[model samples]
Target chain A: MARDTRERLLDAGLALFAGNGLAGTTVSDLEARAGLRAGSGSFYRHFTSKEALFEAVVRQELDRFRTSIGDTTIGESTVADVKIALALEFHEALTTLGQLGQLEAIIHRDAHAMGDLFDEVEGLYNAALDASAARLNQLMESGQLPRRDPQALAVTIRSTLIGYHLNTQSFRRSARRVPPADLIAILIDLISSK
Target chain B: MARDTRERLLDAGLALFAGNGLAGTTVSDLEARAGLRAGSGSFYRHFTSKEALFEAVVRQELDRFRTSIGDTTIGESTVADVKIALALEFHEALTTLGQLGQLEAIIHRDAHAMGDLFDEVEGLYNAALDASAARLNQLMESGQLPRRDPQALAVTIRSTLIGYHLNTQSFRRSARRVPPADLIAILIDLISSK
Candidate 1:
């Protein structure tokens, strides 16, 4: 029961923190969202403070992301197959990162107060870049991709995906302007073109 | 003097709104930041409410941006010249958008409450995309660039730049991972590759 309550608290923390940010969200807000009586001391029973709860929320989300990425296995034989596989990866990445939008907003708003938590998130971002660079390098070695700086290509691909994600997520109207498939098709054409 | 105060208020609003957000900043905070006596009605004398001041600040920034873009004339004869020109444009864009980082954070945080202001900003964003598409089309027509969906290409280019900017600005450590020139060079190579 304690573990369940702790999970509930973490879930509530993620939602409320994303909505109201660190300074705006109160202890009572978390408790009420968690199905506990508002203004009750149940919050204290689970965590030391709101900041601690925020930390827990971030760490839990990162672990879930790590697990999800670890489970992904990209096995494709041809360049065309790799392109399709990469498109799926891009879609999955968009979904995963979209879920973390609120957390991202909180981090952007409260980076100064977040301290080490911010570093941990940055580490995750860099790891993603490194992973992307490795994948591109493998593709290049197998003659599936054109010869180019894998690191630069990784950054390019990651940036394009992130940019599209931010535009569609942040602006309601931009969703219709450029579809994911169109962007992905162009990206594949650009990098694979001899 | 009143006009000067209004300008100062807008300036202060941009910095304060970026740092503390709209709700977190009080009128007294704006007044103090603008060199007016705190608790005085100086803020009221300039604008009706905080929201109105925010609207003015956004509009003024947009106007400044329009003026700057209008002043730029990219006249490169050769493909290599066009590449250098585009790189310069990217650098200029990074600096401009970086200046708006705080404004963007506030917009992301307070989009629900921003109403029409949000639409106006979205309009400006789409306008940028349109401008980029037009430029790409021109390059393709002139045979300086290969033919593709110009809109998709514009989206790709813009997304990459935005992704890099967000990564570098949001995280202190990401600035060192990939230099702007390296990313730009790879992007140029990708699109121009036959």
Candidate 2:
């Protein structure tokens, strides 16, 4: 029961913080969202302060992201299979990016003051890119992929994914009528050895 | 003169809004930054409220962006020249993106509340993408580039550029050692017909 309440509070924190920001959100607001009385001290039971709750929210989101990435294993044998696997990976990453949108807004807003937390987030992002580069390197070595700079290719692939996400989601732009699946297919065609 | 003061106020608002945000910034902050008396009603003479100042700031930034895009012409005759032109375009766009970083954070944070403003920003972004696609289509028609889905290719190229910019600037990640120039070169290689 205690752990459940903690989880609820964290969930509430993520939503509220992402919506209203750290400075805008109040302790009572968090408690109410978490199913506690409006003026009750229940929030204090789980968090010493709003900042603590914000930190917990960020950490929890990161953990969920890390776990999702870890749970997936890419073991495609053919180039076609690799393309399929990559498309799935793109979808999954886009989903995670969408979920983290709120947290990202908060992070970008408070980045100047929250150096340590920002570093943690950036570190995880870089690590993900590195892992992606390693996978691409393996494919190149196996001759399943063309031998370009694997790291550069990884960055290019990741950038294209992120750009598409931002265009459709954050920017809410039309993307010139290029659907995600179409973009992914064209991307694969462009990068794969012909 | 009065016009100079208005310009100063807009400049100050951009810096302050990007740094402290709309809620965190005050009228006095604007006046102080613009070299007026901190608590004076000088700001009132120029703008009705903080919100008005913010609207002006956003419009001014967008206008500047549109103007920059208008002033550039891509007249490259060779594939290699097109690559160089694209690189310069990417650099310019990245600079604009960097300048608008603070406004972007504010937009993402208040997107739910700022419906009309968000629409206006989204329109500009989509228009920019459309222009890029048209340019790419022209290149393809002239046989300077490969005959692929021009719109999709535009998105792919744009996403790569934006991804690299975000990695280096916003996320502050290492990008797995892929520099912007190298990424652009690889991207051209991937998309161009052999």
Model 2: fraction of the reference interface contacts it also forms: 0.67
Candidate 1 lDDT, A75-124, residue by residue in tens? 33253677787777777777766877766767766677677877777777
Q: Return the lDDT, model 1, position B102.
A: 65
Model 1 lDDT tens row, B1-194: 45688788998998887776677678999999888999998899989999899778777776776676665555332446777777777777777778767666677666776777777777777777788888889989989788999998888888888878777777864443778888888888888876
Runs off by more than 4 Å, candidate 1? A1-6, A27-32, A36-45, A75-80, A173-176, B1-6, B26-32, B35-49, B75-80, B173-176
Write down the worst ten-residue block by lDDT for model 1 chain A. Answer: A71-80
Worst 10 residues of 1 chain B by lDDT: B70-79
lDDT of 2 by residue, B1-194 (tens): 46699999999988888666776678999999999999999999999999898888888877776776676564333546766766677766767677766666566555654557777877777777888889889878978777888788888888777667765756565476777678877887787734
Error of 1 at B11 (Å): 2.5
Q: DockQ score of candidate 1?
A: 0.57
- For model 1, the TM-score of its B chain against the native B chain is 0.84
Going through the candidates in order, their DockQ values are 0.57, 0.59
| CA lDDT, every model vs. true structure | 0.78, 0.76
Q: What TM-score does chain A of model 2 get?
A: 0.80
**How many Å off is the CA of A127 in candidate 2?**
1.5
